[model samples]
Target: MPVLVATVIGLTLIGTTARDVVSVNPEIATAATVFCGIFVQALPFLVLGVVVSGAVATFVTPDRLARWLPRRPATAILTAGVGGATLPGCECGSVPIARRLFGDGTVGAAALTFMLAAPAINPVVLIATAVAFPGEPLMVLARCIASLLTAISMGALWAKFGQPRWITRNLLRPTQQQDSRFSTFTEAARHDFLQAASFLVVGAAAAAALHVLVPSWMFDHLAGQLLLGILVLAALAVVLALCSEADAFVAASLSMLPLVPRLVFLVVGPAIDIKLFAMQAGMFGRAFAIRFAPATLVVATTVATGVGLLILGAR
Candidate 1:
């Protein structure tokens, strides 16, 4: 599927270039320049996520995690949600870690919750939000509340209606063992890095194209209607698929949009996006990814809007 998508994109670029649809040197050159920077910025975090995910997968025994976790479901969910703050990497990195946890026999719903919450609610993201919103601490609070609420809500929904059997059979297959934990960890890390780095390349190319082709005036036209702006930003989040570490900076640069809409950008981004959807589709079954991704989109957008308006007043 990724190959097909990439082929389509390449063909489109070729067609456009041949037809002079976009400026010859300027557009391609601009895209190349922007993508180079974006790729460099995102690669390190991708590497970090893969390493941590691999380590967790290869070395961290399920028994160890289970022993440390609270026995109660609610406690476990809340702990996982709040524990997102401690994870140092962005949303892109969280996917592999969450998958590793599930594969290693950690709770599926709980791991999913952590995947969504941790990137957005973590200290790195929070600090980025704080910097982005500067004097408006409420923006940071709204982002946190929205992230937690969305994660918890999705978790509860999965608990009630999700087919654990599907997860068990398709998504969380156990990793093969090796004689040495150190060697296993290194191997897993290398595998994860390659996988994530490839996806990051795809995402960066898309983001750079959008940056070059989409006019800044586009956002300006949608500024006044708060709900509309939030919806638009939510869609943009899916398309941009920016790293959580840098998304706030992007949001900050979009000074045309109001605080509430930008807040939605931060809240919904880590939970759902095109690159993430692609990654999830690969890791989980296609049917499962389809349902889960949309579910998260609806929930995250709704929660973000509600929290944003409640905290910051209706824009």
Candidate 2:
């Protein structure tokens, strides 16, 4: 399916008829190309994410994760932030995994940290970011640092103020299907890919439409107004609900926006997109999602802005 999609995109981009269409009705052609480009570019990483998510489901249980963490809240939070690299799935898959990992005290905090961090800072996502912006190694670094900090900050906040009552249950209640490991892996991978890919299609379409409709002058204005740019991009991120694995390419495609706003988009999208909000609501309960999702958006935006200033420096 991905290959077929890629082939179609290639034909549209390079074929003479496509060029004629672009010249005749540029906006529609441009939007189509942008949408296809983002989707095709992101497909491989999305596949990789689903595969890794399946492996996580098959091999890594909540009990094993809990056993690995330190007892101290701060240390456990830090550990979980770093350990997020181990789960290379998108935010969709991480929600349920985090649900399984959620518990009392330090472990619960770590679970939340892992949920926020895994989607943004994992190896596959960082690699995709690097690929999307080949000239900007600092973008990858900034994303990693900013995402980690956001995760840890949220974890710390939860440690200090989070009520067990906010969650559906204080104890983790993981799936108990009596299935073979291969069966589990296949089922997990298939489900995640379908759900995540559907959301990715929506994001790509939104990005493509906005690319054509939003004027270049507005982007320049936002670039000049840093705070406004941050807020706008952050809001767009949530509304677009892009998959973590694919968001970098979409950010890269928005050439009019400067790196800082784009960075905010990348960070915020993975941490607290609309789909993630829905997933959190379904998995962790509405009470938890309402508080946690909003906080995550703020923290992710702030941390990404800070990191971008320090690292990318409005460039």
Candidate 3:
């Protein structure tokens, strides 16, 4: 294929360029490692998500998911938020699944809730938060409550105001003619992987550049300023585009800031970030992603701040 040939040529050029660049600027080498690390850490989850989403596309009808959920819209959204706990994976896998589940009307809200909640409220993420902030279990509790609240709020918003037109018709459409179920699943998985993974490369490149360019002194100056700290860390979370399973460790490493910003980091990273935005744009559409991502960011940050002050302050 043309893409395959172009990629091979690009990589060959990069292999030659990397040797020269590393000799000139060592930071480029370090950034490359971080770039590769992000992709390597995310690929398995991406594959899992595509497979899960493919299965959902092939087997789970809209009526089936609708039947499984509560009849009331608000209850269904909340249930979906809670249901996110069942899927133990990072944000990378949740996007495609969300797209697959997004049917017309209220069911779309539940799917979106699950997309946001699964990465943040899942046991693996909570355990990582606990380990990251030892003796401060409040951090874990705050993260869960804040992330769940954000998911629920977004679901509610979508139920009230969402225009299905924002999402591409391709997302809601299934293949009319079925081959074998296995064949359908494989085709869906392969298509999703290619789309999601290609965008992930863009996100990973942005993250690597930000990782290298962000000055360490910036954190030193953020002490005692809660609002500024929250904003900066939220922005950093978006830029770093870290895997939800691992972002807590990175947040913990930033001991310079207060618990609130770190809490904001955990809350915002899983809910809205560069990588998730890219995936959403690919799966849904640019219109949906642009509106949804900023809303999620504001909700996550606000909810995390409120929860952090309550739980962490009480302790």
Model 1 clash tally, residue pairs: 2
Higher-TM-score candidate of 2 and 3: 2
TM-score of each: 0.71, 0.90, 0.70
Question: What's the C-alpha lDDT at position 42 in model 1?
Answer: 50
lDDT of 3: 0.79
- Which stretches of candidate 1 lie above 4 Å from their native place? 1-63, 103-106, 168-220
Tens digits of per-residue lDDT for model 2, 216-314: 888789878989988998999998887888889989998777899999999999899888888888887889999999999888998999999999997
What does the lDDT read for residue 36 in candidate 2? 89
Runs off by more than 4 Å, candidate 3? 1-64, 172-217
lDDT of each model, Cα atoms only? Answer: 0.72, 0.88, 0.79
- Cα TM-score of candidate 1: 0.71
Per-residue lDDT tens digits for candidate 3, residues 1-315, read: 479679979989799776887768878887787677767755665666666656656785544655778768888898889988865545766777677778776789998998999878887677767876887888888899999999999999999999999986375466676589989778777776676567557657765665678676765668667889889989988887766765666676566678888899889988998879988999999999999999999999999889988888622
| lDDT over C-alpha atoms for residue 148 of model 2 | 91
